[model samples]
Target: MWSWVAHRITGFAIFFFLLVHVLDTSLVRVAPETYNAVIGTYKNPIMGIGEAGLVAAIVFHAFNGLRIVLIDFWAKGVKYQKRMFWIVLALFVVTMAGFLPRHLMHVFGGN
Candidate 1:
């Protein structure tokens, strides 16, 4: 139940982030300075946290999606759905642990 809710929420988060990312990237064609300025805003501490969250959303959404696919296609998957969810969660945590520190270091480590 909660996994379903989390999957949906993370899907939406990734979708909206992609939408904004595309829109902002498109600004590069309109004006380089504008694009740079807009991208510069993401350098702040708050946006660094937001970027980390975005990465988390993407990672969770991807793993949950794979779980859903397995549940749908594999006969044994549904039987083990709860366990699979836990595995997905553990994978998410492991992936985030590996990703977040490096990401934060890049974001806050300074140039």
Candidate 2:
């Protein structure tokens, strides 16, 4: 139940992120200066953190979506759904653990 809810929520979040990405990228064609300004603003610490969050969302969504696929297609998918869910979570944590430190260093570490 929770996994289903989370998948839906993450899907929506990803869809919205893509929508915004397209809009921002489109600005380059309509107004080059505005696009430059917008891109420049995204280089700061706050946006860096936001990038990390977006990455986290993408990672979790990808792993969970795969789990859902296995559940739907595999012969014993139903029987092992719970275990797959745990594996999905463990993978998420491991991925984030590996990603966050390097990302934070790049974000906060002075160039």
Candidate 3:
């Protein structure tokens, strides 16, 4: 139940992020300087954190989606759904653990 809710929420988040990404990228053609200025604002630590969140969302959504597929297709899928959810979470945690530190250092290094 919670995974379903999280999946839907993350889907919406990713959609909106892509929408904004498209709009901002379009500015590059209409006004390159404006695009540059808009992109420049993301150099701060706050946006870096936001980027991390976005990556986290993407990773979780992907793995959970695979779990959903297995649930739908495999004959034994339903029986092990709960365990699969835990596996999905384990993967999410390990991936984020690997990603967060390097990304945060880059963001906070002020280089």
Candidate 4:
């Protein structure tokens, strides 16, 4: 139940993020200065945190999607769906643990 809700939410989050990303990236074709100026807004601390959240959403969405596919396709996967969810969650935590510190350092640590 919760996994379904989370999968939907993360899917929407990634969709919206892709929309914004496309719009912003299209600015590059308009003019280099415009693109640079638009991208500059993402340099702030608030955007840094948002970026981390975006990464988390992406990771979770991907892992959950894989689990769903397995459950649907594999003969025995339905029996272990709950266990797979826990495995996905544990993988998410481990992935975030590795990514967040390095990303934060790059974002917050001085150049």
Candidate 5:
């Protein structure tokens, strides 16, 4: 029950990010200079931190979704739900930890 609720919440979160992402990208087509400025603004520290959270949300939503699907169709998978949940959690942590720093550095003009 909780997993289902979380799955829906995360799905919506990812979708919201995707919508904003599409709108932001569309600016590139409307004006190159404006797009550059927007990209620069995205480099702001606040946005950089938000990007890290976005990365974590996307990773968790995707992996947990796969786990849900696998368990739904395969009888054998039902028993491994807890195991898969832990694996997904671990992956989420590792992916976010690695991605956040690199993403922050990239957005903040690192080498």
Candidate 6:
């Protein structure tokens, strides 16, 4: 049940980010300077948090998604579903540990 809920939330989050990304990229075609400025806004701390959230959503979605696929294709995965859940959680922690610092720098004027 948790997996299902996480999957749905992450999917929606990713979709939202994708839409925003596409719109931002489209701005480049309209005006390069404007696009750059918009991207520059990402340096803001608030936007930095959004970026981190995006990363978390993607990572959780992918890991849980792989678990789902494994279950769909093989019976063994069902037996170890709880184990896989912990694996996903561990990976998420490790990924965020690596990602957060760099993201903070990017947001706090590291560029």
Top of the candidates by TM-score: 4
lDDT of 5 by residue, 62-100 (tens): 899989998999898899998989998898888887887
Minimum summed lDDT over a 10-residue window in model 2 is located at 36-45
Off by over 4 Å in 1: none
Question: TM-scores across all candidates?
Answer: 0.94, 0.88, 0.91, 0.97, 0.87, 0.92
Cα displacement (Å) at residue 66, model 1: 0.3
Cα lDDT over the full model 5? 0.85
Tens-digit lDDT string for candidate 6 (1-111): 998999999999899889989998899898889999998887688888988989999999999999899888877989999899999999989988998887787778646
- Candidate 6: deviation at residue 109, Å? 4.3
TM-score for candidate 3:
0.91
Clashes of 2: 0
For candidate 5, give the lDDT of residue 42: 75
The residue-by-residue lDDT of candidate 3 on 9-76, one tens digit each, is 99999999999999988888978799999988777889999999999999999999999999999999
Question: Number of the top candidate by lDDT?
Answer: 4
Please list the Cα RMSD from the true structure of every candidate, rounded to 1 decimal place: 1.0, 1.6, 1.3, 0.7, 1.8, 1.2
Model 5: CA > 4 A from native: 108-111
Candidate 6 residues lying further than 4 Å off, grouped into runs, are 109-111
- Model 2, span 36-59: residue lDDT tens: 988787679999999898888888
Q: Model 5 misses residue 29 by how many Å?
A: 1.5
Candidates ranked by lDDT: 4, 3, 1, 2, 6, 5
